[model samples]
Target: MPQARLLPAYLVQRYHGWKATTYQDNKSWYRRLAASGQHPRAMVISCCDSRVHVTSIFGADEGEFFIHRNVANLVPPYTPDGQTHGTSAAVEYAVTSLGVAHIVVLGHSNCGGVKGCLDMCSGEAPELLETSSFVGRWMDILRPGYERVKDVDAAFRARALEKQSVLVSIDNLMTFPFVAKAVEEESLTLHGLWTDVGEGGLEQFDPVRGEFLPV
Candidate 1:
């Protein structure tokens, strides 16, 4: 195994600063959480993009949300093949163990993953179609979403596909038996959200209108 390097000085300094302030002020709360364990009310599946701050967006505190970040924030259709599936594992734990009441699939504008998917679908990015490309394989989850927006005007297709990624994830979530059972019993709900990273605009998917409305 390769030797692990020490953390950078800036990160170490920041950690010490946080420990002296935020950790000191919330010591008791942290201890209580450690003892009582987490009981988050929602599970947020959001993009791996640093700009998409799920906690900051909702002003959520520690232990309040079970977050799972992935490339493009995707949830694949249920494939119980006993393979290593990180996203599916997180969902299973959140629904069956944590009993989260809501699952939010968050997407955003100006997303590189969405752009990559659009390029791959349009034959502009052939490298992503390689069998050895992990990103390309993972992005297969959004191919259906791409098909839905392929006919959209080129100027709006990227944005449209970004929202469709959220919708696709929501649809895929229902394929999980436990998730479907919880929703059927009214114990859980699903939501899709799209944000404009540059404009700080937020919109939510409305099933009734089949479109995203400003939130």
Candidate 2:
């Protein structure tokens, strides 16, 4: 077996600091969580971008949210083909096991994954077109979203596509049988959101208006 390297000194120091402060202060809470297990009421599907802080945005405490992060915060159409599907697996667990009442697909401004998808679809990012590029293949899920905003003005295309990615994920979430059933029975609800990384602004998708409105 390959030996794993030790954590960096900086990370170890940070851990020690956290253990001495946060963990020590909330020792009983941590012990209760360990003994009981997580029972988050919501599942947040967010982008892998470090700037998009899911917990901080909602002011969530430990064991409050079941978060799944990926490129562009995508949820691909359900496919039960006996292949590995990490996002799908997370959704299944969140719905069937965790019984989360809400699933929020959170997209953000200046998202690199969305930008890459736009570039790739426009043929500008040729390297991502290669079969071996995992990101390219993953971003393929957003092709339908790209198609919707392909005619948008140059200045606003990226932002438009970013929101569309969240909508697409919400639509894709319904493709899962378990998710659909849960929603139909009124046990689960889905939401779409977009955040301005620079301005710290947030908007939510209103299904009735089919538009994103400030929140």
Provide the clashing-pair count of each candidate structure: 0, 0
TM-score result, candidate 1: 0.98
Residue 118's lDDT in candidate 2:
98
Candidate 2: tens digits of C-alpha lDDT, residues 116-190? 999999999999999999999999999999999999999999999999999999999999999999999999999
> TM-score of every model?
0.98, 0.98
- How well is each residue in 108-171 modelled by candidate 1, as lDDT tens digits? 9888998999999999999999999899999999999999999999999999999989999999
Residue-level error in angstroms, candidate 2, position 99? 0.3
Residue 109, candidate 2: C-alpha displacement in angstroms: 0.7
Cα error of candidate 1 at position 8, Å: 0.6
